[model samples]
Target: MRLMRIGEPGHERPVLASPEGRHHDLSSVTADIDGAFLAALADDPGLVPEPERLPETDIAGHRIGPPVARPSALLCIGQNYAAHAAESGAAPPEQPILFYKSPNTIVGPYDDVLIPRGSKKTDWEVELAVVIGRRASYLDSPADAAAHIAGYAVSNDVSERAFQLEESGGQWSKGKSCATFNPLGPVLVTADEAGDPQGMRLRSYVNGEPRQDSGTADMIFGVAHLVHHLSQYLVLEPGDIINTGTPQGVALSGRFPYLGDGDVMELEISGLGGQRSVCRPA
Candidate 1:
């Protein structure tokens, strides 16, 4: 199922996108798409009631917000893709290198991506995000990671290279947590619908020009390994989001120019829908 939230920022309503390309309101069944709703659906897939088709005109003009409500944690994996790590002048880590993006960075898929104050190296990363459905801590094995995932979504891990490197005291979060730095989801597709998370094609474009083009198949540490590895250090609760890193092609590599005001960014994953954001000064 392709679940979503639609309306203005902070006032979105839960909806389900039908196979026929129409939207059906899911508010009657759940107040919002969040941890509780995900857990409930996991217990009983039939918990969602018959969807009421929304008028095409209304949906066509409305804004699309992040699929899930505010999550408890916004976690990220660094250099999970070998090619990406090489471009950044780093080697593949022996274990999953983790980082955090402040939950406040979350924004709608199509919202404007803010270029932070005094910023000059803002970059784009198209990644596949995993949403946790069940609580996980010290999992028995990587195979168990599947049962804990709610679904997957398209995530743009927007970054500020200068703040991340020169000014961050070596910590990456400083450059990753600016407001609206993470533009997530036009939809959160269920795991069943997303199929294999490690085989999807992820691509990014700036102002209609291709920038990053790669596949999850190139990931050095796949989704299951990251989840299991992370659970050993901290609890992965429902609604927690894990951004599984990007595959090469970003401004940080000096391959393309950094984002500037009025630049448009378009990102997509094969099954998880796409995102489009216009860069603007904060």
Candidate 2:
């Protein structure tokens, strides 16, 4: 099953997509698809009504919001893919490289991404996003990672090279935390139903041309390792997001020109659904 929210921003209605292709209203189950609701669902799966019992709803034309509302923390993994590190002209890190994008960067899957003022190095990154279902700290092992995860979603890790590389001195968050930089979700596919996180294929396109075509299997440090590794360093709260990382083929590689106004970016993961966004001036 997949959890979703549809309608205008700040006013979306919770929804659940069943395996049989039915979309049911989830408002009766929770106020919003947020940390509290995810934590409750983790504690009690029966809290949600059965698919057949909920009212079936049509959401064909409405806007799709981020499946989970503002996460308490929006964490990111850098250079998790070896090829991506090579493309960025850096040696593959021996351990996971962590960074943070402000939670406010979250926006709907189909929303417009803004080109930050005075920017010329905007780029696109398609990633598989992990949504935490419960708090975790100092996990015993990588195998324990799945239990704390709610599901997965597609994320666009939009970036500005100038801010990230030149102006920031050393830290990378400045280029990463701009408003509307992280475009996530059409829905969140529960872990049990999302198959193997490391087995899925993720891809991206800009204005109809393919930019990235790679599988998660290429990741140097897979999902479970990242989760387990992160828990040892910080307390991961429910509804926090971990953007596993993006594969090679971004503009930062110098193979393609930077993004400008009117460019369209479409990102997709095998089972997690896809996101198509337009670029506009901030």
The estimated TM-scores of all candidates read: 0.97, 0.98
Which has the greatest TM-score? 2
Q: Rate the local accuracy (lDDT) of all candidates.
A: 0.92, 0.94
- Residue 135 local lDDT, model 1: 90
Q: Stretches of candidate 1 above 4 Å error?
A: 50-58
| Residue lDDT tens for model 1, 101-140 | 9988999999999999999999999999999998999999
Evaluated at residue 156, the lDDT of candidate 2 is 93
lDDT for each residue of candidate 2 in 1-282, tens digit (9 for 90 to 100) = 699999898999899999888899998889899999999999998888889999999999999899989799999999999999999999999999999999999999999999999999999999999999989999999999999999999999999989999998899999999999999998999888899999999999999999999999999999999999999999999899999999999999989888999999999999998999999999
lDDT of 1 at 49: 60
